[model samples]
Target: MKRIICILSMLLCMAAETVMAARAPVSEATEECLGCHSSIHPGIVEEWQNSRHARITPREALGVTGLARKVSARTVPDYLLPTAVGCAECHTLNAKVHADTFEHNGVSIHLAVSPRDCATCHTEEAVRYSGNLMAHARKNLAANPLYQDLQQQILGRPVRREGKLTFEPPAAETRQSGCFYCHGTRLEVVGMETRDTVLGEMEFPRLSGWPNQGVGRVNTDGSLGSCAACHTRHAFSIEMARKPHTCRECHVGPDVPAYKVYASSKHGNIYAAMNRQWDFSAVPWTVGKDFTAPTCATCHISLVVNTDGQVLARRTHEMSGRLAWRIFGLIYAHPHPMNPDTTRIRNKSGQPLPTDFDGTYAAEYLIDAGEQVRRTETMQAICLGCHSASWVRGHWKRFERTIRETRSDIRAATGIMADIWARGFAKGPDSDDSPFNEAIERTWCDAWLFYANTVRFSAAMAGGGDYSVFADGRYQLSRRIQELNDWLELRNQLFPPTPPIALRGLPEKPYRVQ
Candidate 1:
């Protein structure tokens, strides 16, 4: 019995030793990777070296308190705790699970690091961002039939061929450079192909919709968004994400124009002049000390702090937390919707609101009124950091009034278009014919899409007098209305009015001379 007991103890000790060896940190392997990559990609190596990732080991970071503890690994293997973040740490964590991993010179590597991989460390941010509008941007825009119809009508050219109107789709190059650049394109793996390199022949993923960093990118591993959209590659600098130029990648246009309006504002001027002196890397970004004026991130995403270093608000990946109203004013000005899932929402009339109304805010599909008010107050609190309460209140009042005024103008234009459609001057709204092909419909679209959006964005951002008055604002609004009236009058003359039907029986006998 003593011999059997001793034999059992020896076996248990051997099993424990084998498990520890298997769990040992791959820091030595990481060093070998850096040794070669450091010479081949020195700039990337330098950037990583400067990053906080390289400076702090998992063990050191796990020992800290507060936010540090929250972001650190909850339970790191004993072997990995001592190594600073490096190439092998990320690429080889779970090699067998990835679909696109390849073996190179006796090491396994994945070409793409998916959100699932990043979530291993940034669990909270990954989850929050998964629900963000940006994560579903491709589906919301591409999956909607109405949006596709508009895209085909607007982006494509219509020509009368063989006595019938035929739509010619836009060139592939134009779409790739324009809309899809930001809205994201669906990715597909064509298959694996062999390529000859200095290392010898190797197999690599043949992918489409690649070399893109659009926010809603559909990665090969089935993730929804690209962290690189804002963070950028290897460096993944916070400063880049916090700047306005990064957002300008998609937001700068006649319809959106957020970055354009902001660039011309007083706050933009201050940022341009003094941003070099500011410390963008600081946590709990101080309002006065870190920056005198607000950047896009400052107002939307950053965890702001007072001058005394007291936190005023927590950071958020869900950007809509402070936005009460969506100023895009698609058909008319409306409140922000609950989520980006346009398919499930319906309006008061029981019709599909997302397909019919451009910007109608379905109350049931969104957060309650109380929650909206709270969000509005949260935004106002941010404004209070620089302006007086009265000033903030007055500014918001003006902004609200501006939205109402813009909606009124849009309604007038809509009436004219509806009248035109009713009288058969153009194809009716519900007809199979394309509503946007005619001259009048195009003009009406511009009224709501371009000019009205400019006025609202200008008002909301406090863009100076010039933008609201001259640069596609009130002046364009009035001009567009006049153009619509002129077109209607000309169309009436061309068609001519039909004579009134002759009255039957006794009524026809008494015709008065005018």
Candidate 2:
């Protein structure tokens, strides 16, 4: 018994040493941080304090929670009680501890509390976010200048992205960084070397880890990120990552509007009605097998594990997951490799180069379809567990038509804009300016991004059935369209650009609507 006790103590000491050794030597102030934080936050403090963000790994930290912990011989074992992901200690930084708990408000408290604050907790997550086009403020605003143009109608005045108070500005603060809270700094942090809070305005690192939690954080040392945004810290449990609750943080906004989209999907409906059926505790989650219906992870992330399980992988944290295609774009289907055919690519090697487009046709075909058809099929299959196959098919068939029509309206709006330019009102191809003319932007904004997202999201799920239509789907859509028309007429714009007459002269382009 005495020998075992001695050996265990030695093991504990060695574990502590292993953790300490992995970290960079602390500066005097950082030393002060290490001294008190580890004691207060304990294992999680030490564990995540030395995470990839601490060491500078470009990939983001884990969003999933950790497994349960055990206390033996009065000493806590390897696992922990919902804290920051412990990198190598709890296994890689991505593993979820258990199941069903994805709300990460800890990010708001730990880092800056704004949409721009994503970098506060999801710095690495933002890279993929920027690529998503929806998260890119510049790109998204450019896509539909009207979203920004119509702000005054809803917000009553424009606010800065910084969440600052102002009269009528160019853009509202929420539109700027998707928040009305926090300073909306691109980055917020404290330098261990400088040993001080060096952000919008603060004295300490907030909750330590250099006080960085801006969603779009730009970082002080030119290194950019905010790992704490999504995965959070202090009690970063896997259960939190498993639930759809975590995504609501920023997803439920006017811009990158996912909260509305999800609320309308058939999968969302089934899950909401039958959430109890899901067995979130399972690994590599599936829809019917592990639980009952589907969740966000079922259609977006990892391959389907069973039928009702939601095993969102630890390796992915882009919010968009590792998904390739941008489905919500003007056109449907993904571009090139993001969307690929293995057999076609293999056959192409025997033929000519890039000029021989036919040679790699198969490879291109692979790119055109769903990368993981099984997952898509699995999601649809979950609906069968409740409704009949014919019922499901019939609904999608109608849905497909609605999507097509909505897309047509979008094309019509674009056509109107193009005609205005082709004639004499706006800049033509020869000109380099496509600046938002607040007026013209107002027209296009309602035509697509807003109305489009709402109607499309409504069609994607249980259409007029529930209260979805009034909540976010049609209410926002109609308002946007009305705003656009009101702005267009007020600006003396050629509404719809002489529709039927000009339709003949408009240039042709291949478009994929649903």
Q: Show where candidate 2 strays beyond 4 Å.
A: 1-35, 38-228, 264-279, 286-290, 302-304, 307-325, 330-366, 369-375, 378-388, 422-431, 463-514
| Residue 413, model 1: Cα distance from true site in angstroms | 1.6
CA RMSD, predictions in order: 12.8, 13.5
Candidate 2 residue lDDT tens string, 61-150: 232333211111122222332232232222212223211112221211222333233333334444454443223323223223223333
Tens digits of per-residue lDDT, candidate 1, 1-514, equal 9999999999999997875443324388788888878887898877776666676677776777753243534766676778777787777766776666778668887766666677776677777778777877777667655455567776766789889775677665555455667877666667899999655687887767766677777766787778878877676777888889998888886888888888888888898999999988776688888888888888788888888666666677677778777777556667766776655555553433421333345667767778768888888877888899999999899988998888878877876776676567777443445556677788988888888988888888888779877887889888998888788779778876577322121111111111
For candidate 1, give the lDDT. 0.72
Candidate 1 deviant stretches above 4 angstroms: 1-26, 67-80, 92-98, 157-160, 163-166, 170-174, 346-361, 496-514
TM-score of each: 0.84, 0.51
In model 1, what is the error at residue 170, expressed in angstroms? 4.4
Q: Give residue 198's lDDT in candidate 1 (0 to 100).
A: 53
Q: Give, for candidate 1, the lowest lDDT window spanning 10 residues.
A: 505-514
Query: lDDT of each structure?
Result: 0.72, 0.42
